[model samples]
Target: MSRSILDEAHIHPAVRSIVANNHANVIAEVKAAIASNPIVVVGMAQNPFPRKARRVLDDIKATYVYLEYGSYLSGWRPRTALKMWTGWPTFPMIFVNGILIGGANDLQRLIASGELSGLVAA
Candidate 1:
């Protein structure tokens, strides 16, 4: 089988087991969403970045799916493993066309440069 960046060698064993049971469908679900929608955002509610990112997307009328997990999940630990899995160290990990598009700041930069609109429209 092909290996992804989230390969077992890179992730902690506990994180892997947590993902296997609790978040096994995350990557697949995000992939399917991004396939049909152009943008997919995974983040936590307590983090201001994700909310801000949502507002920005709303302002631009961008089609996207925001998956907020941190606070909503009991004890809010899976997001940590997810963070390790994605290798992104913050909330609001945005994806455009199935590609990691960084966080709110990156999105703002793209919006400022007019690339965000082009990406969402495409």
Candidate 2:
């Protein structure tokens, strides 16, 4: 399926600025997070269309895990792992460092505000 119209995967100016301003720190933080927790980003597949979200994850160099309840039932379902975001019904759910980062829109907003880099740094 095609990507959703609401998919704002483009890197915002604030994100670019944050990266440019704190490149070394951001990279070090991200590396540390991934090194500490191999599964830093989990991408749940709530919808059939997930290109945009996947692209965003790829751009950020985050590991993407597709969790489609219908496709397969495993010992650890993505929903079960991320029990906090019960309000949202779709997939492409992003989790950074074990924290719920919302869906595509939320990610875009975070990037736009430069909070994504801060979160990574934190």
Candidate 3:
């Protein structure tokens, strides 16, 4: 199936501009928030964890940031910031409205039983 939530010729102009102009910043902000929140999940991309986590985020129309350690620590030493925020050392962190949802196993359990959708939708 299609990953897109949009229909052809029905693009919202404001959303298009926001996506184009501020995508990077938006992603960064979400990443930082995930690092800080207790209701978000963080994991590795190569791990199966992120696949389902990503699907849930997409299903709920949630915006997320997928970060590698190097990129996450690129300019301002995100490791320090992340440590201060989450106290956890990991990647592929998922956040919703700036809340942490735990890691891969946690996400899997939530997704398998459909609890993830309820939380995300809320």
Candidate 4:
């Protein structure tokens, strides 16, 4: 999937300005993390799913980066943009190798199915 359409920097100048102004450094931070980290988790402080996902990653000894947004702050704008961009309707948007992997439940399912282990191993 092409990530350019979803990236704030690549979007329209007006939209990019809005997201940048509202989110400050979230978009840049997320972009950097996704580019540099093999596994990235984007979630909010109030969301338990991200924490659960983190726990699962830790249990599996997976190297990942967790980007925590806000439940009630300026960071929520970037979170909303990311949710829209990814077309995912929940928190803890997990990405493996720059690919979306759903949430904690999805991670658990992958773990149960042994697919996540394979991905992490590779």
Candidate 5:
């Protein structure tokens, strides 16, 4: 289930370099957090969904690392880099056991179905 991306050769070399290095540091930070934590919630400021996701995790007594980017007004570029990296278009990108399990509502479904406990337990 991999997504399609433009081939490197299709992009000009100069453009390729820029794309490669675009917000690399932020991506690195996120990569480090994901590597260190089994449950990582990548979110943004002023986004209600991320907070809702956090609350859900709290109710389940799940331990997770949360990383928030810029709010609606600012920091969209840095967050865009994240969107390019993960291919998830929405905020509150929640990952469990190093795998993306979608956002808050998805999280709720997993919990309601008794799958979230198994995921965290694993």
Candidate 6:
């Protein structure tokens, strides 16, 4: 269940700090949202999946928070920071009760199976 990460001993000492703190502000923002909100969606602009995810949530009348980063044209560095942080390769990284439940299609499956309703009050 966990992905492999470089051990501290294997990484050069000089770059450890840089690796740890790269785009830390963005991470902090998402972390803060996760801590405070029962459901959080980390997404990027101009991505249809994120929009679809939002629409689905809207249909259920779920209370959630959404954080959007860059689009196809710009702001990718921050998005990369998120990808590295979560190890989830795509956008619309939906979190419920601070647990990442995967993206839009995943959300649809959860909804269809009636699993997501157990996590968040709709």
Error of 4 at 101 (Å): 0.7
Which 10 residues in a row give candidate 2 its minimum summed lDDT?
78-87
Clashes of 4: 0
Candidate 1 weakest lDDT stretch, 10 residues = 1-10
RMSD (CA, Å), candidate 3 to true, equals 14.2
> Mind giving the per-residue lDDT tens digits that candidate 5 earns over 1-93?
879998899999879889999999999998988888878999999999999999989987889999988899998999999899999999989
The digit string of per-residue lDDT tens for model 2 on 3-117 reads 3432225657657654344334433443455456523443433443355666765787765454333332442343443332234455555555556676777777887798877
Which residue pairs show collisions in model 5?
A: none
TM-score for each of the candidates: 0.72, 0.45, 0.45, 0.74, 0.94, 0.95
lDDT tens digits, residue span 1-122, model 3: 33433453586875766434433553466566565543455444355556667776677565665554344325335444554355544554556556565665666677778877677666
Candidate 2, pairs of clashing residues: 44-92, 46-91
Which regions of candidate 4 deviate over 4 angstroms?
1-25, 72-74
TM-score of 1: 0.72
User: Each candidate's lDDT (Cα)?
Assistant: 0.77, 0.52, 0.55, 0.80, 0.90, 0.92
Candidate 3 global TM-score: 0.45
List model 1 lDDT by residue over 8-80, tens digit each.
Answer: 6887886777656665466566557778768888887677889999999899887788877757555266676
Instruction: Order candidates by lDDT, high to low.
Output: 6, 5, 4, 1, 3, 2
Better of 1 and 6 by TM-score: 6
Instruction: Kindly indicate the candidate among 3 and 6 with the higher TM-score.
Output: 6
Q: Is candidate 4 or candidate 6 better by TM-score?
A: 6
Task: Return the lDDT, model 2, position 85.
Answer: 26
84: Cα error in model 2, Å:
7.9
On lDDT, who's better, 3 or 6?
6
